[model samples]
Target: MHELSLMGDVLALVKRDAEARGFAEITRVRLLVGDLSNALPDALEMAFDMYKAEGTAMLASEAQLALELRQARATCVLCGLDYVPERSAAAAMCPVCRFPGGRITEGEEFKVLSYEGR
Candidate 1:
């Protein structure tokens, strides 16, 4: 999965920052993942485990990856309704007005929130 590459980039960035800060090992990483971000949480965790198994110098043996899941939300222009959107649907639909022109208000986030190292 693309999560491998994504995790690789994340680790590389974290390692660089940690080294610059004189941190010997990274203990934890926290990520904010949105439902519409297209990155699977399970795959990201597996990728993190794979990298940790490689015994990377900057990563602690017990390094942990924590994910904060953000739910996808949409607001209907026609009906003024706010609801969770269907991820697989091409367009967000409003249940009240049956409009397929709802605007997405949240979700679509994929970023590293924080990292702990010492």
Candidate 2:
């Protein structure tokens, strides 16, 4: 699965950071995943448990998952005005100018915003 590969990258990053900071063991890892980011937390946890066996850092680490919400930015085609929408997961049209299909501007990001370890 893609989550397995993603976990591998996460583990590598944690290890790299731990080694650089001289941390003997990682007790916890807090990750902020955006709502629009296509990632499965359960899969990540399972993969981390499977991959961190016998590892110095993650063997005792606890993976914490936090959700971050992002309002989708859309532009009204009729009025040429950009605004953030209220809801996600819908092809919401512009209410003010009645644009049939507003252009999306944001809500597509996947990255590790913050990590806590040691």
Candidate 3:
């Protein structure tokens, strides 16, 4: 899965920053994963575990991964209605006015929120 490479990139970035700050090992990582981010949380976790199992030097033996799921949200301009959108839908649609052009307000995030190292 692409999550393997994605997690690799994240860990590399964290390792670089943490080492620059004089940290010896990464203890935790927190990610904000939106529903529409196209990155699977389970796959990410598996990738993290694989890295940990490999005994990566920058990762602590008990390193933890925390994924904060963000729900997809959209707002209809025609009806002024805000609602959650289906993750697999091609476009955001408003339930109230049945508008097919609802503007997405959130849930496209796929980033590292924070990392802990020491």
Give the TM-score of each candidate: 0.93, 0.61, 0.94
Model 1 residue-pair collision total: 0
lDDT by residue (1-118, candidate 2, tens digit) is 7888887786678768877887665655556554445766677677767776646445454545444555457788779888776564366478787666788777655556655565
lDDT of 1 by residue, 1-118 (tens): 9999999999999899999999999999999999988899999999999999997737899899999999999999998999998867899999788899799988989898999998
> Compared to the true structure, candidate 3 yields what TM-score?
0.94
Query: Which runs of model 1 end up more than 4 angstroms from their true locations?
Result: none
Residue pairs in candidate 3 whose N, alpha carbon or C atoms collide under 3 angstroms: none
Clashes of each: 0, 0, 0
Cα deviation of 109 in candidate 2 (Å)?
2.3
Q: After superposition, how far is residue 42 of candidate 2 from its true place, in Å?
A: 2.8
Off by over 4 Å in 3: none
Best candidate, lDDT-wise? Answer: 1
If ranked by lDDT, best first, what sequence of candidates would result?
1, 3, 2
Among the numbered candidates, top TM-score falls to 3
lDDT of 2 at 81: 80
Mark the regions of model 2 whose C-alpha exceeds 4 Å error after superposition.
52-106
Q: CA shift at 5, candidate 3, in angstroms?
A: 0.9
Q: How far is candidate 3 from the true structure (C-alpha RMSD, Å)?
A: 1.2
**Reference-based lDDT, each prediction:** 0.92, 0.65, 0.90
